[model samples]
Each structure stands twice: as C-alpha cells, then as structure tokens.
Target chain A: MGLAERRRILELQQTILPERERELADICGRAIPYAVDWDTFADDAEALSLLEYSACHRVAMALRVVCRDALGREAVREGLREVAIANVADTSAMALTFEGGVLRLRGAWGQRSAGMFGDAEIGALLSARL
Target chain B: MRILLIALLASTAWYGASRMRGASATRRALRELGHVAVPRRLADREPEERDGLALFAFGRVPGSPQYMGSTTPYAERLVVAAWTPTTRAEAADRALRTVALGVEGLTWEADAGGDAVAVGTGTYEANMARRPAWVLVRDDSARGLTFAYMAWRRDASREAALRTLERVAGSFAPALPTAEYLALARARGGVR
Candidate 1:
C-alpha cells in the first residue's frame, strides 16, 4: 500500500479504538443510579472506575501509534519500551520482544493485548509471527 | 431523530458484515485454542469462583475473522468481547458492519475487580426492535447470549450472566495462542 493508503488505514484503526471505550462507557453508564443507591452495589462504582482507567491506558497507546512515522519504525519500537513505564500491565509472559519496529510480545500485556494498541489474540490465533 | 436513524442504519451494516465474516463460529468448540487456556490454568484457579464464568476474547472487539492480508498491523490482534453483542433487527445487522473493531473490550472487566458505574447503553431501534450488541456475532447462539446478558442488572441476573458466559466460552475453549504467542513461547525457552 502507498503511504497515503497506510495513513488512511492507520487513521481508521485509530478511529475504532475510541469506540471500544465508548461502548464500555455506555455499558457502565446504565447502572450508576442503582449503584449509588444500593449500599452493597458500591463495587459497581469501583469497577467502572477501573475500566475507565484501563481504557485510558489503551487510548494513550493508540495515540502513540498514530504519532509514529512509518519510516521511523525502529524509533517507534523503542518508543514501546518506554511504554513499560506507563501504567500498562505487565505483558512479559505472553510473547517475544523483537528488535524491529514491531513490539512482538516476549511478555505481552497478557490480558487481551493482541496488538500494542489492538487485540492480543490475533497475534496468537493467526500465529502472527512478529 | 434523523441522526439516530442514520446511526441505526450504520449499525445494521456492521452487524451484517460481522455475521458474514466468520465461516465457522457455531456452537463448535475450537480444539486449536486449547493451548491458550491450559487445563492446568483452569485447574490452578479455584473452581467455585471460576465456575459459571469465562472470558470472551478476540483479536479486536469487532475485528473481522477473515484473515485478511499476509500480516495485519499489530493493532488488529484480538478482541476481548466479554459478551457477544447482537441484534434481531435488520437495522442492527447493518449497524454492526459499519462500526469498526475496538481493541480494549476486555481490559476493564474482571469478575471481582474494580470501581464501575453502569452507564446507559444506546440502542439503534424504533421501540419495536432492539439489540444490545457491543460486537456482532457470527451465529445465533452468540447473539442470544449477548441479548440476555445485556439485560441483566441484579446479582442473580449477573450470576446467570456469568453462567451464560461459561457456557458460551465452553463452546470455544483452549484459547489457542496466536502466532504472536507461538513466537513468545519459542523465545522463552531460547538461550537467555
């Protein structure tokens, strides 16, 4: 694909990440009133809060993906290493970390991070040998 | 109302596309994925808590199962859709196809974790037709599960939801490690 096409694809990919957050937001929003009123349901608030935090972490990663230039692949890969300092959950047990621009999981996010900014399962399902 | 209508139209497209994407996601249990979730992994955890509960994960929340391109960007890896979101209305099927995949569907949910607020969920319906979908399913069973779980609000219902999850996931267990996992598995044993 040409640079223009790549950019468009990347843009579309970025566009979709937000929808996940929105859907989760929508799902949680439905129960706030009941949660606040019910003493035992207080856990509801915490669950939503944690989900929000987790969503933010993903948003940050997506931002970094959008920022990278295709030619500077190595730099982008290094950029991912720095992400370890971010609030990302440890992904070390899931996969291999390769030297090229892509962050192949030696130990990935392990939860569901198939991609740095996407699903981790495809990498597994497709045997996406990074 | 006009925008809602348009949005509804868009949602229907998405649903149709998702259903058409996978060739075989019926009530079949995937033997390939058995490696991902070890019998040991299930065994190690306490059965009481783990029972009647399971996790739904895909490379992307709504990613097409079609193995497009030799190598898709890492961002399109897997989706962790906790529940199968689906619809009966033709409009919903259309909407499902229009919306793209979301990657972080799984991160926020843990059975016993967190502070959460159940915000309102919007539906693309005209009162008579509705679907509570986050991701469109490839088959009827997945759609049915999503419909039921989306309606739950109480503890008993949530427990039921959990059981439903286990049943649905039981149909797709041994979550295979993606190629990504395969490499990681090989490297770990490689000389340090």
Candidate 2:
C-alpha cells in the first residue's frame, strides 16, 4: 500500500466503522506495509505528521491488546498524546523519520531495543508483523 | 628554587579550582538523597559516575544546575523522574507506562495511594546480560518520586541505592516552587 492508499483506509476507518478493535486491527493490518515500506521521506513535511499520528494510534492499539481494558487503553493514549504534543515536531528529541527503505526514530535513550524508535513500545509494535 | 615554588603554587591552584566544580548544592542534594562515600583517590577521573543519578528541578532560576548529570551510555542506565501534571490521574497514567515497560508485559497494579505503580523484572540470573534494574515512578503533588538502580555484579551498590531512595522518599518534603520555577516547569512538560 502507498501513502495515499493508507490515508484512504484511515479515512474509511474513521468514517465507516463504529471504532471497534477488530475492525481497527484489520485496517491497520492492511496499512502497515505501506507505512513501513517507504524510503526518502526526508522532504515531505506532511508525511512526518501522518507518520507521527499513525505511530501514536498504532501504539495505543498495541497497548489495548496487552491491557484489554478500554478505560486503561484510553488513558494510555491520553498520556502518550501529552508526551507527543509536549515534545513538538521540531524540538522533540523523538521524531519519526524514514531512511534506507524503513522508518526510523532518532534521539531515544536506554537499551538500543528500548529507545531504538524514540518510543520503545511503538518500535516493538511497528517492527513486528502484527 | 624560586621556579619550583611558583610551579607548585600553580598546580595547587588548578587542583583547588577543579574541585570547586562539585558545588555545595550538588553535595547537599546528593547527601539528602543518600550519603556519598567519596573515594580516597582524586586523580584523573570522569566527572560523573559510571552508574550515576541526579535530580533536576525544572525552572528559570540560575539556582538549578545547568548540567545535572552525564548523558553517556544512556542504555546502561535507568532514570526514574517526575513531572508535575495537573491531576493525579495523569500522573497514574505516566506511572503505568513505566510499570508496563519494566515488566515487559501487561502486568501492573497501582498502590493504595494511587500515586505509584509497582513492577518487577523477576531475576537476571537466567540471562547474565540482563542488568537487574527496577523502576518506580510516583507522583506526590509537592515532590515526585522516581526510583531506579542498576546492578551488573550483584554487589552492594544496587541495594545501597535502593535503600537511599526509600529513605529519602519516606522523609520527602518538597519546598514550594518559586513562580519562575512553576512557569518554566509548565513550559517543560516532559520528565527528565
């Protein structure tokens, strides 16, 4: 899937569905390939924004899978969104980028695996086939 | 003889100047956090410890040290820090994430206070490479608590660090933040 195609699916997911987990998972499953299989996102400012949003939503989904509680999942999303917003696009040490045919994150701390993608949880989820 | 005297004086002055870098406040903070056993040898050594920790009070005051701690080998270290959020729920959410990450799964439970979450790494004996590190992130409106310690050798340092954190937190009474500190802390939203 391509960026345009992924965006289309996201639009559909937002408009058509009643925000169910299984449905959201199906949409994300289809969109992962397009999101991760890209290179040279260097110049596109909009792509960066989309990637950040997608990353946040996907991470929340992953947390929901582990948490299994709607309230807890919502809390995680709110907390993560606060982290994402406070960091900002330019100033945040953590940011979404593309390089060498895969998406990358910069300026994370802890074990290479821990902060390898700025947010370790997101990195783990994105890297996995799920 | 005159030249030797001048050289000795210069070297002594340099040593005195270098020692001054560890300010009184730093010493006081460390002491308040825990006692520091200063080593006998003070030769050429890295300014910060290989496994070290420090607290940063976000603010505009020059009182806060510009450089709180070293940033090298961030992976080998774990940091427990606090950020003043508007509500207790927000703080609990932040604590939950830390707990989830520590246990590497979905197992986390908040304590009775609703300010902290507890999680454990079980044991590292099975995997020698896994450093035994534990994290506790707590939010008290006046003062936040973040407890982190790394032990690679199964030695005394790890236990000492944990004990110190517990003692300090038990007696914690944070001073009221100045107006400047509050404004700057709000602007700086994330925990260090």
Candidate 3:
C-alpha cells in the first residue's frame, strides 16, 4: 500500500482500537474485574489481533477457576459451553465440564490443559466479580 | 428540612474531598512520568490512573516512518502500559506466570535468557526476532508489571525496538503503593 493509504489505515486503527479496548475491558471486567488490564495486554497490530483469541482463552480459564471455587467443573463447563455457543463458533472438541459443582476434565485435550488456574488468578477473578 | 440540608452539605463536602485526593495522586504520577517520552498523539487521551496503576499508549507518529525517508513505518511500533497490582506479592506471582505464558514462543528461542533479567529493582524479559522486526519486553518491579511489544513489517534492529520499549517504560511513573493499587483495583466501582 502507498504511504497515504497506510497512514489512513493506521489512523483508522488508532481511532478504533482504544474504543474496542474500552468495550472489551468493560465486558470482561463485568465477570472478572482485573480483567480490564487485558485491554492493556495488546500493544500493536499483531498483539491486537491475538487479543480476542487470548481473551477468550483467559476468560475461559477464569471461569474454570470460578467453577472450582463456586459450583464445580461441570456447571462451569456447561455455562462456558452455553456462553461459547452463544458467542463462539466451532468448539466441538473442547473439553471442560462440571457435575455437582465439581470439575471434571475429559478427553486428551482436557487432561493436558488441566490445573492451569491458581489462587491468585482465582482471587483476581473474585476480586473483579465480587 | 434543616437536618436534610445539613446531611446533603456534609456528603457534598466529602465527595469534593475525595475527588481532590484522586486529582492529587494523578498529578503526582504525571510529574513522576516527566522522564518518559510519550508521543503527542497518544498522550492526548491522558493517563488512566487508578491508584498507582496507569494505562496509556505511545508510538511513532501515527503514520510517519520511524525515521525520515524510511518509505515504510517503523518496523517496530509499540504501545506500552504499566500497572502496579493491588495485591503486590500475590499479583506479581500470577503476573510472572502470565508473562511467562505470554512469551512462551520467545522463551523457547535458543538465545533467549534462561530466566528473567534482574535489574536494580525490577525483573525483565525480552523476546526478539531479527526478521519481520518484533520485540516484546515484560518488566516487573515491586510496583507491578510493564509490558511493551513492537512488531514491524520490515527487518528492524533489536536495538531500535529495545530503545522504543525503554523510552515508553521509563515514562510511566507510579505514585501509589501496592496496597493502594489493590484498594483501587478492589474498589466497589469499576473504571470507566
């Protein structure tokens, strides 16, 4: 692209990005307070592109923490899947479920990704939510 | 009626006092940031200061190349943000893990440091690439964590990227302690 064109693109990006960050931060902050900082995590085009992907992953992870602390894995998984279905596409192989407020990991993918959340994260989640 | 008026006056005074304190903190932080060079464009938004954690952006002029006659924008454009988590030790532990995960690919590189770099009062990690011109630095201090990432379309030198990162990082000045950041983070109201 030409300089003027690239400059235009950059200008457009500059205008849109901060608004997008604020919107996303607001959405994430609703469920996880400190999650607002996630908006700051992305600094450029590449990072901005990855922002949505990482954010989904982090929110999913935060939900797992919430499940472990509150209802259980299955409920959290079910809740996650519901939210995912409503908001995401093509999550067929994803594994995370809860039964009786207890979390269970099934499938190879599920087992490998287990135990990702910890106390501080959970605290961050609670601090944001509560 | 008189009692109600008195109560309203008291509440208004308290609110005014609280706002004054917040403004004072923000001014102090801005004063501290005097050493940091923030591009005029991004600095226009003003810093979003909550307790000691501040978030803002800085970069080469939106469209101008990093250097004159460069034909293209700086191979590395960065937006830097610094925050001091309310729960310092606890937040730092989690932040360390978060930064580690964030730079997983960089960590695997042969030249990557085996661990974080320890400077006077901070720990830093950098991910650098020679081609495509990208560099990311994640620095942690008693205050909190500062993240700077830059990626360019062309081959940019590591030194250039690091310089931009440092320039932005050096500009952030935190005024509150961890306890204060925590109090702000945990405050009942959310940041707008």
Candidate 4:
C-alpha cells in the first residue's frame, strides 16, 4: 500500500477506536510536553541493555491484511504488538506497522521510569524488518 | 612506570571482562527467546546467528542497544518511529499514546510446544489502515505470559513498511523462553 492509502486506513481506525481509548492516547500525548528531564540514564550497556530491556517487557503485534483484485492474494498484516513492561499498571506499548510485513514500534514510558527505548535500540527497531 | 603499566593492564582486563559478560548475556537473551547458538563473531567478523535474528548494535561502541527476537512481515512501524524520534525521556509516554491510537490489540506469545497468538486489549477498527506495527505472535508458556517484548513507531511512509512487516511475520514461528533462562533474568531484576 502507498502512503496516501495508509492515511486513509488510519483515519478509519481512529473513528472505530473507543473515545476513552482515544482519550487515553490523547492524555498520554498531552503529558509529553510536560516531561521533566530527570529520568535520564547512561546508555553504556547498549547491547546487553536492549536484551535486558526485552526480557522485562512483553510485546504483541497486530496486522490488517489488504489485497487487490487479482489472481494472487494480498494480506494487510493489521495487528498490534502490545509491549508489556514490568510496572504496577502492567504498562506497555504497541508495535503497529505494515509495508511488506514489518511492524515497527513507538512507545510511552512514565516519568522517572526505565521502560523507554534507548537511541540505539530505537534505531535498530526502525531499521529492522518488523 | 610500574604503576602506569599495572593501570593499563587493569583497564584492558576490565574491558575484556565487560565484553565477555555482554556477549554471554546477549547469547543467553537470544537463547531465552529460543535461539540455541550464542554468537561471538560480531567482533571478529560477521554474526553467526540466524539471518533474521540476532543482537544488533549501531557500531563498535555502545550508546543504545536493541535485542531483536525476529522480524515480522510488517513495516509501517519503522516509518512511524522516524517522525517523533525523542531519544530522551518524558516523550515516550505520549509517543505510545499517539501510536496506540492505531494498533491496540494482538500480541504474540510462546506456547509450550512452540508459539501462539493472543488477542489482547486492541483498540483498532477492523478496516483501519496505517497502524504502528503488525504482529503474528504466540503465547509464551515458559514465561507464564503472552506477548513478550516489542517496539512500535509511527511515520509517513507507513504503508510501505506495513506491507513488508507482514511478510516477515508470516514465514516464521513465535518463540518461548526456557525455565533456566527466565530464572536467570529474574535473578537480575528481570521478569517474564
């Protein structure tokens, strides 16, 4: 699918999601600007840290399959990877993406918390296949 | 001169020990995800792990690290991550909220025999497009849970990445951790 087409899908999904969910997302979105720069940590364990990070969290992926009119079949891998982090709220993010089958992830972590993605880890995830 | 020489040796020794520990732990991480062989060649040459699975670092140094279990046939997640690249804290919570608006369900976990998929708290429209990531995951029995670890990003070129990630997710099986593996991780402030 193309960018234009994807935008259309996003619009549709936005409509379907419950208002409360949207409200939560909006709340999270709103608090971002208020983030204080106190939860910073050293990124020295770049490699081992990601693994350690991975071990502490749980991720789930969702795909919305699409197809065209043809002899072959097309599947829009529409799903979400609910990333589970070890927290009181059992908080985690979702890895939701599509394009030849790669589900990338964007997440949220609370202030003074250690569940956020590091620079190297984020880059690898972006560069990764899904 | 003697003191300087001893200091240099001590520094070298410290570096070696750290590297050894890092490599061993990363291997165990992959093994925890069920990859048997621990690779040690990311230093000397190319990595010896599976083509689509391994521990990848940005360069020879450490700034941030990512443990990649495997790639799914999905894409837009990466593109989404491109736009709001907040390397610092505070913005992550908002990022997740923004991205979560699109993809909200479907996490994979490890099954006893292999892997299985679970439908969790997804807040998506059946026909919606442009999500953060798409996963074909399974239940992880060993870890006593479903949906282990993952990253979700947002972007403009989302459609392209989505198509690709789906393909990657299809041609593989979900993985679960071993008992010893979970125990080890939990021993170090880690949990399943």
User: What's each prediction's TM-score?
Assistant: 0.20, 0.27, 0.31, 0.20
Over B1-192, each residue of candidate 3 has an lDDT whose tens digit, in order, gives 999878865664454333323321111123122224443333223334444354443333223211334232222233333454443334333333332322223332233442242211112223321223244555556445554554342323445445545655655544333343334344423332
Tell me model 3's lDDT, rounded to 2 decimals.
0.35
Q: Lowest summed-lDDT stretch of 10 residues in model 1 chain B?
A: B40-49
For all predictions in the order shown, the interface RMSD in Å is 11.2, 18.4, 15.1, 8.8
Q: Report the C-alpha lDDT of model 2 over A1-130, residue by residue, as the tens digit.
A: 4566456445424632222333334433312222232233333333332432334333433443533555543433333211121112232455554333334443231111122232345535334422
Tens-digit lDDT track of model 4 for A77-123: 12212222221212344233323433333333321124334333433
Q: What ranges in model 1 sit over 4 Å off?
A: A1-64, A67-69, A84-130, B1-91, B95-166, B169-192
Which ten residues in a row are the worst by lDDT in model 2 chain B?
B58-67
True contacts kept of each: 0.00, 0.00, 0.00, 0.00
What's the residue-level lDDT of B44 in candidate 4? 18
| Residue runs of model 3 more than 4 Å from their true location after superposition | A1-130, B1-35, B40-55, B59-131, B153-156
Q: In what order do the candidates fall by TM-score, top score first?
A: 3, 2, 1, 4
Against the correct fold, how does model 2 do in TM-score? Answer: 0.27
Compared with the true structure, what per-residue lDDT tens digits does model 4 show for residues B1-192?
Answer: 999878865664455335434442112123233322222412211211221222211112211112122322121111011011122122223223332334556443333345433212332322322234433223323332222112222211233223333332232222332333233233333211
lDDT per residue (tens digit) for residues B118-161 in model 1: 12222322223333323222222332211112211211133433
Candidate 4: list runs displaced more than 4 Å: A1-130, B1-33, B36-116, B119-137, B142-177, B190-192
Candidate order by lDDT, highest to lowest? Answer: 3, 2, 1, 4
